[model samples]
Target: MVMSLGQGLWMAINAIYAVTVVHLTPGQLGVSVSVAAAIVLVCSIPLGHLADRTGPRTVQMWSFLASAPLTAALLFVSGFWTYLVVVSAQAIAYRAGRSARKAMIAGLILPADRVSVLAYVRAASNVSVSIGACLAGLVLAAGSRLGYQGAVLFTAVAFLLTGALTAREPRVPPVPATAGSALAVLRDGPFLTFTILDGLLTTHALLLDVVLPLWVLRRTDAPRWMSAIILVVNTVLVVGTQTKAARGTDTPAAAARASLQGAGCVAVACVVFAMSDEAALVPACLLLVSGALAHALGEVRQAAGSWAIAFDLAPDHAQGQYQGTHAMGADLGKMFAPAVFTWLVLEHGALGWIVLAVGFAALGTAMPAVVSRGVRMRSGSDPVISTG
Candidate 1:
C-alpha cells in the first residue's frame, strides 16, 4: 500500500511535469528521461550486489534521502542540462532501491509460485498508477508549480517511509557472491535473450510516455482533465485484467506465449492510435486502453517467465546479480526508446505513428521465438505458442 501511494505520488508529479517540462520538446525531455534511465541501469548491478552482501534497508534509506532534494529541485530548473543532472540523480537512487526491492521480493516468496506473486505486485503497481494519474490530473488542472512540486515531495516522503517500513522488517541473510560471475551470467544465452526481449517491451511502454500526451493534446477536444481520465481508464483496465490473465498461466510456456500475444495487442493498439483523429477519439481511447490492458498481460507473463527461468538458472546465492542484470535491460530500453521516439515524432508528424506500429508489430512477431528459445535453453522445454 505504501509502495502504491508512493508510486501514485511520483506518477502524478510526472504527468504534470510531462506537460510542463519533461515532454516540452520531444528531444530535451527524451534526453533527460534517457539519461536518468541510463544512470539507473549503470547503478543497478552494483547496488543489487551490495544489497545482497548487506541488507537493503540502509541502502534504501540513504538513496531516498539523497534523491529527495534532487526531485524537489526539479521545479526550479530552467535548462535541460540541470534537468538531466537532477533527474538522473533521482533515477540512480530510485533504481538502486528498486533493484534491491525486486531482489528482496524474490527472497520473501516461496519458489514454487514466485511468478504469480510477482504478478500481484505488478497489479498493485498498476492500481497505484491509476490512482496516481487521477490525482495528477487534479494537480495539473491547478496549474501551479507548487502543486506539482508538492506531489513529488510527497513521493519522496513515501520513499523515506518505505525505508522506515522496510527497516522495521527483519533483515534477510545476504546472498553470497562469487568471483567473475557477472561475466558468466552475461554469457549465459537464455538470460541474455530474456534481457533483450524485455528491453524491447520497455520500448512499447515508452509509446505511452511519448505518444499519449501528444495524442491527448493534439487529437482530442476533451479538456485537459481528459488526459488523466484516459490514464485512469488505462490503469483501471490493467489492474482489472492482470489478475485473470496471470491466473490463466498454468505453465511457464503458457506464460511466455500469453506475454507475446499481449505484445501483439499493444502493436494493434499502436496502429489504431496512429490512425485516430478528432473523429476517432473515442475509439482511439478505447484502443489505447485495450493496448494498456494487453501490455499488463504481457508484463505478467514476462515477469513470470523471466523470474522462473532466472531463479532456476541462477545458483541460490547469485539471484541478486541475476535480477540486477535483467533490470538493467529494462533500464537500457527505457533510456533508448524516448530518444528514438522523440526523433520520430519530430521528423514525421502522423507518420511517426506508422513507425511505432511497425516497430511494435515486429517486436510482437519476434517475441515468441525469442522466448521459446529462452525457455528451452533455460527451462529445457518447448515454450507454448498459444496464449491462455
Candidate 2:
C-alpha cells in the first residue's frame, strides 16, 4: 500500500510533469518509457540475483531507498536526456523492489495464505491509491509549479517511508548461490513457456486502461464519461470481490484452473464490449458496464492465480531471480500491447475485437497444459538450478 501510494501520487502528475512542465514531446516520453522497460528486461535477473545473494529484505529496502532519490531528481529534469535517464534509473529500482517483495512473500507467507493475503494487499492498494490520487488532485487543481514539485516530493517521501518499513521487517537470509550460470531461470523451457502465457493473459490490464478508451470514444455511442465510470466500477469490484476470487487457490493446479476461468471471463467481456460499438446510448452504457465488471473480476482472479503459480513453481532458493524473470515476461506483454491492440482491434474494427477475444481465450485454454508441463518438468528433473 505504501508503494502504491507513491504510485498514485506520481502517476497523477508524472506524465504532466514530463510533457507539460519539462516540455517533452509525447514521442520522446514514449521512447523514454519504452527504453526503461527494455532496460528492466535486461537488468531484472541480475538484480534479483542480488536479492538471493544478499537478502530479499535488504534488496527491497535499498531498492526503495535508491528510488526515492531518483524520483525526486525529477525536479531537476530540464531536458529529454535528463528525464529519460531519471525515469530509466527509477524503473530499474522499482522492478528490483518488486522482485524482492515477491521473494519476501514467498519466504514469509505460508503457501496456503499467500494468495489471500496478496488479495488483501491489492485491495488495500486500490483504496490507498485513490486517497493518494485525491491528495495529488488538490495540487493539480491549484496549477502551480511549486505545488507539482511538492506533490512529487510527497511521492519521494512515500518511497523513503516504504523503505524504512521494509527495513523493519524480519530478515529472511539470502539463499546460497547454486552451481551454473546466474541465468539458469532463462534456461528453464517449461517455466519460460508458462511466463509467456501468463504474460499474454496479463495484457488484460492494457485492454482495459488503453484500448477500452479508444473503443469507447471512436467505436461506441457510450457517453464520454463511461471510461471513468468503468474504471470506478473496476476498482469497486476489485476491492469487494478479490478475496472471494482468491479463495481455494492454494496450489498451482487449482491456481491454473482459476486462471483459465478468469481468462474466459475477460474474453466474454471483450465480446460484450465489441457489441457495444453500434448500440444506442443506454444499451451501450449497459454493455460497457457489464464488460467492465467481467474484466475486473478476471483481472483479480488472474492476478491471484499468477501469484500462486509463480511462487509454487519456482525453486525456493531462486524465488527472487525467478520472480524477476516472470515480471519481464509480463513487461514484454505490456510493452507490446498498445501496438498489438491498435493493429488488431482499432484498425480492423469489430473483427479485430473478435481476434483479440480469440487470442485471450486461447491464452486461457492453454494455461492448464502449460502449468502442468512446468510442474512435470520440475518434479522430474529439477531442470532449473537449485540448492537441493
Best by TM-score: 1
TM-score of 2: 0.83
Per-residue accuracy of model 2 over 37-102 as CA lDDT, tens digit each: 778888888988888888899999999999889989999999999998998899899998999988
Alpha-carbon RMSD, candidate 1? 4.6
Candidate 2: list runs displaced more than 4 Å.
9-31, 75-83, 133-151, 178-181, 208-229, 272-289, 342-353, 381-388
lDDT of 1 by residue, 165-257 (tens): 666765667755543344445566666676767676657666555556655666644455555665676667667666566664555556556
**Candidate 1 clash pair list:** none
Stretches of candidate 1 above 4 Å error? Answer: 12-24, 178-182, 248-251, 278-312, 345-350, 375-388
How do the predictions measure up, each by TM-score? Answer: 0.86, 0.83
Model 1, TM vs. native: 0.86
